[model samples]
Every structure is written in C-alpha cells, then in structure tokens.
Target chain A: MVGSDVFRAKFFSLYLPLTLYLVFLLFPFYWMLIVSFKPTNDLFDMKFSPFWIQQFTLENYLYLFQNTDFITWLKNTLIVSIVSTILSLVCSIFIGYALARLRFPGSNFLGLGIFLAYLVPPTLLFLPLAQVISELGLNNTYWALILTYPTQLIPFASWLLMGYFRTIPKEIEESAMADGCSRIQILFRMVLPLSVPGLLSAGIFCFTLCWNEFLYALIFMSSGSMKTIPVGTVSDLIKADTLFWGALMASAVLGSFPIAFIYSFFVKHYVSGLTAGAVKG
Target chain B: MAANARLKSFSMRDFFDRERNLGIMLFMAYPFFLGIWLSLTDSMIGRAGQFIGLRNFVDLLTDTIFHQTAKNTFIYALVTVPFKAMLGLGLALILNRHMRFSSPVRAAVMMPWIVPTALSSLGWFMIFDPVFSPISWLFRNMGLISKNINFLGDPILAISSVCWANIWRGVPFFGITILAGLQSVPQELHEAAAIDGASVWHRFRHVTIPSIKGVVLIASLLSIIWTFADFQLIYILTKGGPANETHIFGTYTYQIGLQATEIGMGAAISLYMFPILAVFAILLLIYLRKEQ
Candidate 1:
C-alpha cells in the first residue's frame, strides 16, 4: 500500500487544499484585523494595497476605549456569561448525576427530554421567554440573560455531564461508597475531579454562547451600558450616523478576543464536546 | 433527620433525583409548555389574553412577510447545508489523513467557527463594502470589471453575500464533525477494497461514503436547523435589507414579534419551526441510539 504515486497524491490533495481552506477561513478575520489597525486615510485609498496596511495605529482601540461604553459592555457581557455559566453548570451537574446515577422514575425520558430541549432552536423559545422575563420585571436587567441562558446551557451541560459520567468506571463509585462516602461526597470528590475536561468544555460552550448571543441581548438589554459584546459592538460601532470603519473593525476585534481566547485555550475540550453532538453529525 | 442518616447508610439505594428534576422542570419543560400555550393565545405585552386558538398561525399563513421569510429561510438553508456538508467532508477527508501538523491544522480549521458569527459578519460587512471591497479591487485591477460591485444593495447579490458568510462560518463545524466520522471508519474496509484491486475512487465510493453517510446526514441536518434559525449574520450584514429580500425566519420573527410588538404573531411564526426541527431531532436521536 506504500505507493510512490500516492505520496505525491497526498501532498497535492492534503497540503494544497488545506492551505486554500485555511486562507478562506482566516482571511475575513485577517481583513478585520487589518482594517482595525489601518489609518483612516490608508483604509480608503485605493492606491495603497488593500491587503497590507502601511500605517497602523491604536487610534481606533483608543477611541473605542475612550469614546464609548465599551468597558461597560465588556463588563456586562462578562458578568452575564460567567453567572450564566456557573448557574447552568450547577444545574447540569445535578441533572447529569441524577440521569447517570439514579434509578428514578422517568429518568431516561427526562434525559432525552433535556437533549431534545437543547435541540430546540432559540428562535422557537425566545418570544415566549421574552414574555416570561418581562412578567418577572427582568427586562433591561442582566438577570434576564442570566435566567434565560440556562435554558440552552443546562441542556448542553447536563448532556455533556451525563456522557462524561457514563465513562467513569462504576467500580470506582462502589469503592468510594465502600470507603464511607455519601452520594454527594463521591460525586464532588471523585466524579467531579475526573470530569474536569467535560466541565471545562461545557463551561466554555456556555460562555461562548452567552457572549455570542444577539437576539435576546438585543431585546432585553436596551440600556446603553448593558449590551453584550456582539450586540454592543454592532450598535455602538456600526451606527447609521457614524459608520467609522476603523473603529467598527476595532470593536469587532476587541469583542471577539475573549471568545477567541476561551475557544483556543479550551480547544481540546470544546472540540470533544462539539463532536459529541456531531458524532451523530 | 433520622431519615437522612438512614439514607446515607443506604446511599446506593436512596440517592435523590431532586436536583436533576428541578433543573429540567424549570429550564426545559416550563418554556416548552409556555411556548405552545402562547402560540395559541392572544398573548401580548406580558399579558396572557383569552385563548384565540390558531389565529396567530392562521394570520402567519396569510402574512406576506411571513411567506417571503419562509421562502428565504428555505433557500438559505437549502443552499448552505449541502455546501457545508460537501466542503466539510472534503476538509475532513484531507485532515483525516496522517499528517505531521494535523493538530495545528485542526485548530486552524476551527477558526471560522471559533470567532463569533456576528463579529465575523462585521468583518464581512466591511469586506463587502460597495466602494472598498478587496475582491472588487482585485477584479478591477485584473481588468475584469470597470468598477466596484454592490454586494449588499441588490437583492440577489445581498442573498449571495449573506449566504457566503453563512457558508464560511459553517464549513469548519461540518469539517470537524465529518472528520471525526472519517477517523472512525475501519482501516480494514479500505485495505480490503484495495486488496481486491479496487481503484481509489472505488474504495472511497464503497468504504468512505457508506461509513460517513450517517455522519453527513446528521451534520447537514444540524446545519439546516442552525441556518434556518440564523438571525445574527443576516441581522448584522443585511438585516433582510434591499426591501427585506434576505430575511430568514429568525430575523422576521424578531422584527414582527419583538420590534413591532406583535408578540402573538412572532410566537406563532416561530412555532412553524417545530415540525421541521422535530423531524431532524428525531432522526438524529435514532441514528445516535443506533450508533451507541
């Protein structure tokens, strides 16, 4: 099977195509970064090559930091994402354990139900959710996102946790039980420690979803200071009256940094979790 | 108190499922039921009015915007799902090959998907800028065209621009998922086919395609649901502009339901997703169950 022709075939097939795909995938982001740094004059000038920016500056970032509620939006997004992640993680841990460990009535159905809930698109849920949030006087508050985000997060987290939980040898739990550990004690000490990768992936998934969330954030958090990163960047930068390309690109780069960071840092866990759904995919 | 101690003594027998049930009830069941109920009633502005049966749905069926959005959403999904599947499979096949830099390449592959969609859409928005598009500049420089193209101003061009963004963002997801599938195909199948004097194309047709068929179906199905419900890219780049030519179901629902304060209609319009998504979800679960 080790053939001479296939060696060259692999290069042409794999390397060339990958390079092209990489360029296609990375170019938009590169363009964003280039535009963000390019001087306003250089940005518009057709004479200057569009691919590379000659004169770069922090003028756009400085303006973003100084002129707008960029910091506030960042803080709001952080708080919402973190709180929602923690909330869903807690809820999912419980559900995950119960579904994985306990022999309760309809546990199987409930597990499948949660998975289906995750399958349900946010479009179908957001309208009724908006009403429910407003009824509780949560509109324009961080709590609106905090309470609602768990709808998606809890299902995803619990499903992931359940999968992780299933992989640990049951004998380990039995030994812990023999060692006089309570149910919760064993879960906290043994299962939780072992499922760190799963937990991290679930948490990252939640944080990413929360940060990227636009529709609900657009609706609930109308206040100038309350927009999440995606909502805030688009509204604050791409206004009809303004249309500052450099600043807009700057806000986009800045807004995407945390998500990009988390995604890359936890790339392993994230990919595993992503492929779990896509295993079927 | 005594019962608690007794429970601890029989920990294996008496573990409570309270925590799990509570989470499901609040997060999954509540909104699910509320969604169905609100779709049936004349609910608006936080007030649940007397039930109006399928009036909202009836109105949606007749609504011109709803009709257009339904068509647009279908078109968007139909176009993107297959492209994402084929391209994803192509990348997956390549990446699945034994390579030295496969790990870094995998990470690089995920970049489009990693960056948030709306943020990337902003990048796209500028790249598609009528006067300053780099693609336009390149074409002009090559003497291919006289001037820049209006990518988002014309309806057909606008749809193409939005779908391009969608496809770009979606391909990585499909690629990795299909790559996972490709990796799982037993080597013996390919080797066996090769030993039978099968050509590379025959080996791929017999061994690769069959092994990855379920994964392709599921991946493309997921893409369909996401693309159909997609609000962000369209919202950020075009917002269904040029006379609402690019509006998908997601943006249309937001416009009518939330922006216009026609909550009943929005809820109803969104409810249409139930049948389509339910079909996909069931198919996925069935295949997943079979896999396990």
Candidate 2:
C-alpha cells in the first residue's frame, strides 16, 4: 500500500507538467480549429471558450473553395511541390551515388561545397537569384520557382542522400556490376531500390519546404493564378476592408492537412530524416 | 592474335579508367559559380549599372540602414537563441518521463512547427490587431489596461511581438532536438548520481547538460542562422512598418531590392550577411569535425 502510494505520487508529479506543456503548445491550433467552426461574430469575443463549438458550420470551408482562388492556389502548390520533389530526388540520387561510390578527385570538395551551399541562407541568395531568373526570362511563371528552388534544394538533398547512400554496402553494387549491369542500371536496379525510404523522406522534406516557402514565391511569382498556396492564401484572402477569420482558418487547416497527414503516416522515418539532416549537419 | 588480344584489353581498361568528373562539375557550375558572378556584378534586371569595383561594398559600409539591420540581426539572434534553447529544454525536461498519452502529447507539441509559417504569422497578426485583438480584450477585461493595445503598432512592442511569434514557432525545434538528446542519455547516469546523493540540480548540471551540450550547440546555431534570415513571419506580420523600426536584414534587403528597385544596393546588403553566416558555418564545421 505504501509502495503503491509512492508510485502514484511519482506518476502525477512527472505527468502533470508534461500535460500542461502539451496543452500550451496545442492551444493555438485547437483555437484555430474552433474558430474555423464559429460564426464570424464569435471569433473576437472576450469570453471565448476554446475547443468547443457553440454553433458549428461548414460555410467557412464552402466559401474558401467557392468564393476564392483557393482551389487554383492548391493546384499550383501541388504542381510546384511535386515537380520540385521529383527533380530534387533525381539530381540528388545521381550526385549522392557518385559521391558515395565513385572515386573522383574533387568529390570531397564537391561534398563540402554542397553543404556550404545548403548553409547559405536563402535570404542572401534570393536577391541574386531574382536577377538570374529575370535574365532567363522565367519571371512571373511557375518555372521560375521550379528552377530556383533546386538551387537551394539540391545541395541539402544531395548531402542527406549522400550520407544515407554511403551506408549501403559496396558489395551489393559490385555484384550487380559483375552480373553485366551498367553503372546506371546498377543504380536503378539496386541502389535506388534500397534507398526508397531515404528518397521518400527527402521528397517529403522538399515538398513541405516548397509548400511553405513564402519569400521566393512572393518575389518570383506576381500573378494570383501563378502564386503558391502560402503567398496566394495571404494575398487573395485577407484584404484592406475585412478579415475573413473563418475562411482564413479553414484554408490554414486544409492547406496544412496534406503534409500533416503525410507526416503522421511516416512519423518515425520523418523524424529520422529531420534529425539526420538537422542534428548531424 | 596475341597483339590483337592485348590491344582489346588496353581499350577495355581505358573505358573503365576514364574519369567523368566533368558531369558533376557541370551540374554545380550554373548554381554555385553563377551565383558568385551575379553577386559581384552590378547587373540588375533591365537596369544597367556600371561595374564599379568595390563601390557597393563602400556604400554598404557607410549606410545607416545596413548598420541598423546588422545590429537588429545580432540582437534578434541573441534574444531568440537563449529563449528557444531554454523553452525547448524546459519542454524536453517536462516531457522526458514516461507518462500516459506522451506520444500524442509529443505530436501536439510539434504542431506549431509543422504548420506553415505564413499561416501562423497571419494568425498571430490577427491576434495582435488593435481593434479586434482577443489578447487586448482579455487584458481589458482583467483590468490590465484601459485601451485595446496594438501590439504591433509601437516599435518596441512590435519587436517584442515578432520575437514572441518567432519564439513560439522555434520552441518546438529545440524541444524535439533536446528531447531526442535527453532520451539518449542513459537513466543509469541519473540513478548513479542519485545513489551518490547528488541533488536534482547537481545531477542535471553535470549529467544532463553535458550529455546534450552538442545538440544544444547545434540547435542554437541553427536557430541563429534561421532567425537571422527569417523574412516571412516578420514580413507577413508587420512588413517593416510604422517607420521601418522592425526591419531586420532580410526584410530590409527585400524592400530595397524588390520594392524599392535598388537591386545593386540590395545585393550589397544581402552579401553582407554572408560573412557572419560563414563564420558560424565554419564554427559548426569545426565542432562537427571535433565530434567525429
């Protein structure tokens, strides 16, 4: 009985603070969810109780899709993210494989350079990049973002995949080569099959970064139809006269849901990918 | 027959031995080398400025805006680094224990980070709006103030408000990193310290801090770099408004480059950030090498 009481005391002491911390962290999102359901008048009430719906409505969502360019922005975001991820994967795979497997003289320098490029903040690079994009006559188009984003994405993706690729045993590739496979064939057949999880993680990272990217999209793309979700959602929704809190929150929830869903499904691998790039790099 | 066979072997060996280093170099050249070239020249989009050697640098040196931005950047880095580090550490300590629903709690804690910054900043912007602020309403109701406070209107409050938003967004990074670090520290160390009659503070100071110092350093440095270059949150919230009082280097550069159309000046300002970031990068590399 004494031991049980002691255990109970320990449990509460440890658990209470954790629960409170989580509540604090999660309150904003919960508030967003709640506000999305509330009528516009209730959003700014002083005695606003959280996590409860006095009167629930789906009008906010309906308005976001029907009354705004939310769908167009969504489509633009999807295209940009998907294309960017695929390109980054293809480039990083070739580069990572070379760095991991091939014996080139400047390979180490290239590896270090890639990491340095990754460390170079986009704030610093984006200005120069704007000039370059204009010079290519790609401004005000989705291609501008697709082209410039790789400048940032490639280095990090290559570095990450290089690390993961290095851990793959040489014997597997060597045997594949012995079995009359070309370098490209061996990579496609063996290295790629083994590195799908890493590639997926990298793809997701690229997609999320591109989806949330604001500055590049803000500067590069000017038109409403061309804007990615982050930029589009802001410019299109909130205006000088009125703030659509309900539609805004609904858009926020919907825009974030796909990535959040992807993250939840692959939580462990996602965490590992983040830690591998963040902690180690 | 022997001569022909030897010739075939030599050609086969040559095919295997030839270095195709050109492809990798060619791939990196456009982005890396071209970026450097663009930074050096005074070439703006559709505007011709002379390639006056080092004039941009000289102007950057004398510019008050640049000085203000640099100072602001450093101040931001200083304030945010410790705030996030401590908050993250606090969260990690609280969540380290085995508790019911800990996994869901952990996921909940990460929601802010997973949410897009623009969206969150917009949400925060609404909350800080003068006329409709819930915070102001709450404060007024509680008799803290007589008027609805515009948190982002005044310069001092604006800076603080941006810092608060950044801290909220950034805390999860530290929390997750430090939690991962804390989990890796064996419980045996804590048990051993307890057996030795070490107080909670002593065990934490000795075992916990030392175990996570590397992660702490890496997290802090990353936060510094990230905060130094952060443009979206501040831009969406305030847009360096109410007398340019809240302009950091990143936003200032954007305003100069994109909005004001002084591309050369913007490029110069942007380039100024590189040296500081490079110093941090070198420090990180050295620390990483030492760890290895």
Candidate 3:
C-alpha cells in the first residue's frame, strides 16, 4: 500500500510537472479554439478575459468558408500531399528495398546518399528550386509542389521504409524465392505483404510531411486559387496592418485539423516510424 | 561472402536498386548544384549576370543586418536546443512512468508537433500579440509588471520570443524520440544497479544515460540541424521582423531572394548554412554507421 510519503513524492515529481508541461503544450490550442469562437468586438476588447468566450459566434468560420478560397486551398493541399506522397512512396519502396535487402554494388553509399538528402532542408534549396520551377513552367500550378516536394519526401520515405524492410524476416523471401518467385514478384507477393505496418507508417509519414510543408508551397504557388492551406491562410488572412484574429485563428484551427485527424488514427504507427527514422537513419 | 559473390558481376538486381538514383539526380542533385552555382553568380530575377564568386558572401560579412541575423541565429539555436533537450528528456522520464491515460497523454503531448508549423505558429502569434496578449495581461493582473511587455516589438525580446516558440514546438519531438530511447533502456539493468546499492540518480546517470546515448545524440544533432535551418515558425511569428532582429537563414533568404529578387545573394545566404550543418551531418553519418 502507498504511504503519504510515497504519495507526496509521486505528486511532486510526476503529476505536478506533467500537468504543467501539458498546459504548455496545449495552451495555444486552447487559445486558438476560444479565439476562433469569439465575436470580433470581444476579440479586440482588452477588458475581456482571454480564456473565456464572450458571445460565441461562427462568423469567423463562415468567413473562412465563404468569403475566402479556403476550400480551394484545402483541395490544393490534399492533391499536392496525396500525389507527391504516392510518387515518393513508389520510388522509395524500390530504393528502400534495394538498400535494405539487395546485395547491389554501392548500396550502402546510396543509402548514405539518401540519408544526406533528407537533411538538406528546403530553406537552402527554395531559391534555386524556384528558378527550376519557373523554367519548367510549373510555377503557380500544383505540379510545382507535386514535383519538388519529393526532393525532401523521397529521402525521408526511403530512409524510414529501409528501416522497416530490415525488420522483416529474410527467410520468408528466401522461401518465396525457392518457390520460383522472381525478385519483383517476391517483393510484391511476400515482402510487401509482411510489411503492411511499415508501408502504412511510411505512407502516413510522407503524407504528413507534404501536408506540413510551407516554404516551397509559399514560393512556388503565387496565385490565390492555387495556394496550399498554410500559404493561403497566412498570405490571405492577414491583410495590411489590421489582423483578423478570429478568422486567422479559425484558419489555423481548420488548417491543422486534417493532419491532427489523420494522426489520431495512426499515432502508434507515426511514433514508431519517427523512432525508426531517427534511431536507425 | 554474399556481397563478394554479388559484386562479381552486374545484374538486374543492381539496376532495380538504382531506381531512386534518377529521381535523386533530377530533384536533389540538380537543385543542390544549381544552388551552389547560383551562389557563385550575381543572378537576379529577370537578368542573368556574370559570375561574381564569393562577393555575395563577402558582402554579407560586412552587412550589419546580416551580422545581426547571424548572431540571432546562433543565439536562437543555442538557447532553444539546451532548453528543448533538457525539458524533452525530463518529459520522457516523466512519461516513462506508470500512469493512467498514458496513451492519450502521449498523443496530446505530440499535438503541437503533429500540427503544421505554419498553422500552430499562428496560435503563438496570437498569444504573443502585443496589445491583446493574455500573458502580458496575466502578468499585469498578478502585479508582476505595470506596463504591457512588447513580446515581438523590442529587438532582444523579439529573438527570445522566437526562441521560446521554437522550444515549445521542438520539445515534443525530443520528448517522444527520447521516450522511444527510454523504453529501450531495459528494466533489468536498473534493477541490477538498484540491487548494487546505487542511488536512483546514480542508476539513471550510469544505466539510463549510457543506453540512450546514441538516440540522444542523433536526436540532438538532428534538432540542431533543423533548428539552424528552421524558417516556417520564425517566418510566421515575426517575419524576421521588428527590424530583422529575428531573421534566420530561411526567412532572410526568402526576404532577399524572393522579395528583393536578389536570387544570387539569397542562395549565398542559404549556402552559408551548409558548412555548419555539414559538420553536424558528418557527425551524424559517423554515429549512424556505428549504429549499424
């Protein structure tokens, strides 16, 4: 049985610190939620408590939905995230398989190459890539994002999927090969089947990376209708001088909802993928 | 033996394995080389110019604003990394305990990181709003200060504000990765240490720290690299503003390259980030090879 001494130790060491950390983690979200619901007058009023909503309204949400091109931005984001993810996934699966299981020449070097590629952040590449996008006549089109995003995404996906592939028992593939299965066939019929979790984790992680991407989207897509959610929300919502706090916060909430929703369903897979990439790559 | 046999001759497997090479060449290699080339030239948006090797970089050496930005970048990384690493490790330790609602708590803890930085940063933007800031209001109400503290307006406060937001966003990543590292620290080792009459702190310092050392190093190196190249959070929160006090490599590159149409200068600024990051990348490569 727990005594008061043990209880006091647990409370101070565990509960108190954890609670404070959670508040730090979740307070911005709480503020966004409350601010999104408050009317414009209450939003600007200094007298009102920032914690509570005064005369809650949906006008901000309505403004986001109707008065702006939010839906277009959302659609644009979905298309870019999905198409690039699928493209990167197919390409990385082959590469990851090669590095993880194949005995090809220079596989380790190539594997190292892929890992290094992921570390090259977009900030360093956007300027030159912008010129490339323009030269290809893909600027202001979803293709700009769909094409360039893989520069970052492929490496990430390959690195993670390689880790996953290594975890599968090689004997399964050896047995399938004994049954007269070719390498590609063995990959599809045997290797891929046993690695569903890995595939899901890689796919989900790639999708989230694309979804959360900002710099390239902001630079590559300049038109209003073609912008992704992050770029569109920031560029459109905040006008000259005066900030539309409610609509901006609402956009922030709405923009984050899709990733948060997808993540809720795949938290375990995401965490595992994250660790595999960090620890292994 | 297998590698030697396979290395005897080129086969279809080698071709299949090189599948990602073409994409890598086209996407990553091309842009990377182009960025380097751009740094050597005085290229603008509409007009191409002769190669002006190292002038852009040399100009940045003397530029006061770039000096401030460089100093700010180092300050931001220095302040944020230690805080995030420490707090993240602390969080991982706390979460590794036997607790109720552990799954939900873990998920909630990851929310800030899971959400898009471009979006979550907006929430921070609101929280740090000068006139209507809840934090300033709370401080005033608590009689901690008499006047509203300008979070993003003052130069010193602006950089720290950016660092605070970066730490907030970054801690969860450290927490979860370190948590994964923590879980891998076997219970048997701790029990053995305890049986040897070691104190809790001693057991943790010896057993826990050594086991998770690789993870901690990899996570921190990655964090440092990412933080150095970080753009979205600072770009959103302050636009590197209140007079370029908060600009890092990313936002400054965007400002000069895109806004001013100084493509070559922008590329040079971004390439400035490479040498420092390359050191980290080399270390990471060494650690990863050792892991293998």
Give a tens-digit lDDT track for model 1, residues B1-292.
4434433344333444456466556765677678788778876654567789998898788878778888889889887788888888888888887889666678777878877788889999988989879999999999999979999999989998888888899899889888777877888888888999999999989889988888788778778877878888999888888798988888888887777777777778888888887887888788778867
Cα displacement (Å) at residue A201, model 2: 1.9
lDDT of 1 by residue, A1-281 (tens): 57968877877888889888989989998999998998788877888789997997989889989998899999999999999999889978878877777655666787788888778788888888877787788988989999888887888788888877877888788776766777889899999999888788888888888888888898889889788878888887787855888888898898888777666666667667765533632
Question: DockQ scores for all the models shown?
Answer: 0.55, 0.45, 0.64
For all predicted structures, in order, the TM-scores are 0.92, 0.88, 0.96
lDDT of 2 by residue, A100-194 (tens): 66655555786777777777777877776777778788978889888777767887788778777776787666666556666777778888888
DockQ category of candidate 2: acceptable
2 against 3, candidate with superior TM-score: 3
lDDT, model 1, position B200: 90
Superposition error at B110 for model 1 (Å): 0.6
Between prediction 1 and prediction 3, the one with superior DockQ is 3
Best by TM-score: 3
Give per-residue CA lDDT, model 3, range B1-292, as digits (tens): 3433432342545346345486575678788899999889999997786798899999999999899888888887766888998999999999899999887888889998889999999998888888878999889888999998899999888888888988999899999998899987789999999999999999989999998788878888888889899999999889999888889988999999989999999999999999998999999888878976
**Per-model TM-score of chain B:** 0.89, 0.87, 0.93
lDDT of 1 at A228: 83
